[model samples]
Target chain A: MRYAAIEQWSRQQSVLHRRDARAKIGALLAFLIAVSTTAPASRIAFAGYALLLAAAIAAARLPFPALVRRAALVLPVAAGFALVLWFSDERARAVALLEKSFLSAVATLLLVATTPMPELLRALEILHLPRLLVLVIHFLYRYLFVISGQARRMRLAASSRGRLQFRSAAGALAVLFARSWERASGIYRAMLARGFSGQFPALAPPRWRAADAAFFIAAVLASVAVRVAL
Target chain B: MPVIRVRGLRYRYPDGAQALDGVDFDLEPGECVAVLGANGSGKTTFVLHLNGLLEGEGSIEICGLGLKKQNLAQIRSKIGLVFQDSDEQLFMPTLLEDVAFGPMNLGMPREQAVARAQKALELVGMGALLHKAPYHLSSGEKRRAAIAGVLAMEPEILVLDEPTTSLDPPGQRELADLLRALPQAKLLVTHDVFFARALASRAVFFDRGRIAAEGTVEEIVARFNWTQR
Candidate 1:
């Protein structure tokens, strides 16, 4: 259900959503590079990056509160690293770690929010990412929730016990692992039956347009300008 | 000529268990045959060989092409194996992409594959849910989408393993109708006698890796006392 919400968001139409995934990817990369290079001491630079992300989120018509809340998932992990730096007498670096990680997450989230996964993965493949890696990510993203749902049902069945579980789930993590392995084997056989010969095929990849190019150019300029001026 | 031909088929599992032994079978053009057997009687193992998914000591000729390392691609294109679990078969992010997977692998151009996928989806009555993710489909819809995935390959023969496993009566009836209209020679591996009666013109019964009996669905069911009743 949580996965479905993000998928639904990506399918909604907006200017940012309409832009090609490649363009959105390009903007994301530029923003990441800019934020990563900007110093921890540059407070203005961090604000500028945050401003860019907020504007992009707005353009995409995504719910700001939800997006911001989801992006916070990165903070706890970032804060762990930040906490070490703070205790080690590196206060600026601590703040920098949090700022960069959160800003970077929002930027990446913005890209995925606007572009459906298949299109985004196609863009990555078009950019010369390894085909095998793309296929792995494709399957992983598609099946993670399915497997988790199996886990949930397994737990509920245990509760009902009245309940037990699917194929005797019975509170055993090993059962989940075994089930996952079997599920993977079944999927592999299905793939072989459908003529899969190492490469996963997709329908026509999206075409790049002038609008995409313009968007890419503008994003890079804004990101670079912030890094240099701020 | 038979669309599918098998001779002297034998297989032994890695654990030293013999699954299939000295089996011979044939399927005529556009003929649907049901295969019935008790659990672990080699029913699933046998169909896995039709598409060259398993290597065994036998000869398998699908749509006139011999099953071999080099002919696997062609052989697979000739016989679509729809596994029982629709969840495993419909793996793509969306239904349309999943259906298109087969054609694209056969080196059909993307545009042509898209067209074929759309036509196949329409055939299965899933045209409107092109963008729907596989996880969202009801069990019956998932089953149809899985069948559509196979149909897009334009196979000459259809081999469905336990096709009615999770369907309710109405779902089973819908699937039976959809499968009935298909022109491909079909191999139905099922325990559902009523389902077999509805779709298969003839039947084969497997027992401990051998074709123990072959006849009409009623004869096999009666011979084995296979009904739940």
Candidate 2:
């Protein structure tokens, strides 16, 4: 329940934090799309994408080691699939797939590390994303920590009562899920009563300044240059 | 004049268990009434009715407005309900946003909503913690912020469920003081006998889905027959 990992990553402030969250989200998504669209054999293009993601991460001033640790979490499963391709004769295809996944992960990590979850959701809403989808994501983010807190408390209580076992853990998890769902329903009613219409109000509006426009232009030109050069 | 009125109110859960049965109650403007009851005594259910958060059989009115299907928005605007669990009530990321929610929903302009939020925060003495996340606050702070959120609505009636349920001695004292300072009709559902003693001018005992006793503070406290019920 302690989503301290995410909370900790988002507490950092820098130039990256100052930039409009909508721009960051859009750019990172675009980065992912560009990287994924390119063939794995486009070694220079993949390298360029990785460098761009790295620059963004550095600009955010997040701890590199922590970011790397988080980004590395996908390796175990991804490595499993990469091994199959590794044994195949299509080395270029294997490289492309691996590169695509890596760049995509980096883009996501950089985005999340720089922009807080709430702000990111606000950015999505501002970008004219579907209200229902935004609401779903917002609730998930908000309750993830709360439910986790309840689960942790339940586990602690179980341990204190000498009922700590894998079976007991599973049972506690189920109980926590049920209680959290009830809590969620109550919260939903509370929200409805409070006049929570479809959209979450942003703390501050995002301004698409001249610098943001420049950033967008640079991102687009770089993406195009990579595709054509490769 | 009565800000809230309930007569012959009956509510049964979908599972066929009656939560409130033929209960009659009235709350006047600016009067604090503490509802005393044990678990499953229908105290919570009654407060839920005050805000029209739940549906029941028979008549219930808020600020002289009947809680019919179409009157929900107006009833909600006139009555602010603070749930027992602060986590549930304070869902917004920051205290300011959460407090501003009600006013904004009432169609107030952004500047007015924000000003009201700031004032409510000050009323609860939580003005400094406007930007803080609810999850980051202490239990007392969170509770105060939750109440502030309700207060920001500028409702004529404030319904608080267990206002001091999980607080330490100092926190309980602060809560009592805070409740005393607020100038609004308050319907408090709680087991804090001492807090009720300090804040309520009248008391009602709910037992087995009915109002078992209702009278002045001294009248109800001395007649502690509810312990047997």
Candidate 3:
């Protein structure tokens, strides 16, 4: 459901949403690279990165609290590594690890929240990412809702039939897995019926506009400036 | 002329279940035929072979083109197979994208594909929901969107497997009306007796991987006792 909400938000009209997906992807890469390579001791640069993401969130007109809450999902994994670093007496790196990871998640979320999955996948393809990897990502994103819906239905069915014991829950999960496999094959058959071969044909190749170029350039320069100064 | 023709079709699953046994079928141009069968009777399996999705020992032809690996793309474009489960058919993130998928895959330009998809969605009375996620739609809406996706491909023959499986009365009626309005030849596989009577000019009964009977819709229904008690 979170993904669905983000998908809905991506379709909403906004200045940030109007930019080309390729440009946004480029900007996201630059921001991530800048954030990752910054010196661990440079608290000022980390602050600047956080401020930059905050500005983008505002500009995109997204719900700041919700986005921040969602971005914090990355913290648990980052904190695990940070804990190890702290025990090794690298406290500065530990703190920087959490900050950089959280900022990176927010920045990545911004790109995804503004650009639809189709456009995002197309952008990845245009960037010469591996075709198999792009296709995997595409199918994974498309089917997540389906799998989740099945899980919800199973849960409801279980609840209506009385309390779902652990044994029943485990059985339901196995059924879900099998059902998903069957559905995947059916989806493939539908795709074949529509003439899908090995390659997924694009309706139109992405066209880079002057505005897209300007956005990419500005984003890269701003991120670099923040990393270098402050 | 026959829009679809098949003879001596035989298929066995990898697990050794014989799903189709010497099945012969034909679809005349501009005709609608309903296939009635019990569970595991091979109705779905037969339809899957129409667009070369499943291969078997059969001599099949669609729109005068032989069903072969080299002619698969052309055959697929001539026959649009809407699966029984709307959820499976409607896989794209948005309704419009799902509809446009077929046309896009056929190498249509983006503008043309979008236009075709819009037209198809409008035909199914789902034009307003073009941007909605497929998962957000109700069952009836999902079925309409799935049909729109196939219709966007502009196939000469439409093969629908259990088109009314989850539809309510009104939804079934609406789908019947929609199918009647379309001029494409249709092969409908369903167990709904009233629905078949409404849309199918002829009917065939499948029993154990073969066509057990074929005749007028009324005659087949009576002969097979297909209606509910």
Candidate 4:
């Protein structure tokens, strides 16, 4: 029942964590937009953006290896799309496209590292994001790690039992998928019994004040500066 | 008066598997009853019908209100179900939110919803777990929190399915104690004979999607083929 791995990164601390999850999210969206708008040739702006992200990582107190690993796990799939840019006749343009994608990833990584997934989802709800999308994302975050953990155990058990051939891996994936589906179904039923309607009710109302406003304005200013400098 | 009345209830899964075949039963207010069954014996299907979660043939009335589509919201608000697996029941990120969900859905103000959630947690002796994530709680704690979620709704009839399946001995005993102290009508589904003995005043044995036997705790347990206990 312990969700240590899934819940571990979410440490509510410092002024950064206290910012309305909505504010952080809005800032993150703006940052992504700014990163995307910059030409890959704007090395100075990219460097400055990287530095700002590092400052955030430091404030968040996220582990370097953990953060890098999280980033790396994403890189391969994105690298494929980034690979597309490599074929552009103008090498600089290709470099720019690749850099844009990587910088975008950096923004997302920092957002997740600084703000917990659940809080982010709650913030999205407060911001009037689609309820169904928020619910799907929330459930995905909560259950993905748990389900993956189960999958890992299943693989381990199969390997130990001499069933870990290439052929067996597919079967193992199927089995894990089935189990997670069943678990999710049962959990949903249980939730309904406890008065879970389609919408998740907030336990504590999010309060906005001067500090929240300050954070929002500061984030927007940073995005504007990045945009103008690029 | 009976808190729950089920008459000739029939249910079939979408795949056409008969889950509950014309089952009839009654649960009095403020009394504890055990529903015993083998796997696929329709115990879960029967209990789910009590809250109108799964629609079936025949009728279920809770406190005299029919559990039809029109009466579902009212019927659901009055019955709290504790599912067998706590993990399935306590999926909210934090325990407090999970417990508060029911009352909040009932349209209680935020502060009142939170107060009721806290009170329910206190009832289950899980007050210290408010800030903790549901995934971190021990199985027993999760179970208590699951029960607290239903308790927060202030349901008149409390339904539990296999309430102590995977618990340690101490955890099991604690759950038994908690159930014993609960004030609402209890319709418990379980295979644990000892648990049935400790918790229920009466017992109903279900087999192959029908009620095979029903009587006082000793009478049903003694008369049935159940060897455990």
Interface RMSD of each: 1.6, 2.1, 2.2, 2.0
| Residue ranges of candidate 1 with Cα displaced over 4 Å | A1-3, A162-171
Worst 10 residues of 1 chain B by lDDT: B131-140
Model 2, position A218, has a per-residue lDDT of 73
lDDT of 1 by residue, A1-230 (tens): 34566788998999999999988888889889999999889999999988988888888899999998989999999999999999999999999999999999988888888888889898889988999889889989867876887788777777776655555644467888888889989899899999998888766779888999999999999999999999
Which residue pairs in candidate 1 have backbone atoms (N, alpha carbon, C) closer than 3 angstroms, thus clashing?
A160-A163
- C-alpha DockQ for predicted model 4: 0.64
lDDT of 4 by residue, A96-125 (tens): 665666667766776766666667877788
TM-score of the A chain in candidate 1: the value is: 0.92
Q: Model 1 misses residue A26 by how many Å?
A: 0.8
Docking band of candidate 1:
medium
Superior candidate under lDDT, 2 versus 3 = 3
**Fraction of the reference Cα-Cα interface contacts (below 8 Å) that each candidate reproduces:** 0.87, 0.49, 0.78, 0.78
Q: Where does candidate 3 chain B have its weakest 10-residue lDDT segment? A: B89-98
In order of appearance, the predictions have TM-scores of 0.93, 0.92, 0.92, 0.92
Residues B1-229, model 4: lDDT tens digits: 6889989999889998988888989988899999987889999989888887788989789999987777776777899888888778877777888888888888789899899999999999988878787777778888888899899999998999998888998999999999899899999999888899998999999988899999877788778767653
Winner by TM-score? 1
Q: What docking grade applies to model 2?
A: medium
What DockQ do the predictions score, one after another? Answer: 0.74, 0.57, 0.64, 0.64
Which stretches of candidate 3 lie above 4 Å from their native place?
A1-3, A205-214, B109-111
Task: Give the alpha carbon lDDT tens digit for every residue of B1-229 in model 1.
Answer: 9999999999999999999998999999999999999999999999999988888998988878898889989888999999989889988878999999999999999889999999999999999999888887888899999999999999999999899988999999999999999999999999999999999999999999999999999999999998999
Top candidate, metric DockQ: 1
Winner on DockQ (1 vs 3):
1
> lDDT per residue, candidate 2, B1-229, as tens digits?
6999899999999999999999999999999998997799999988887767788998998888888878888888888888898889988877898888888888888889899999999998998988777788888888999898888988888889998977889999988889888898998888877788889999999889999998876687678744332
Error (Å) of candidate 4 at residue B29 is: 1.3
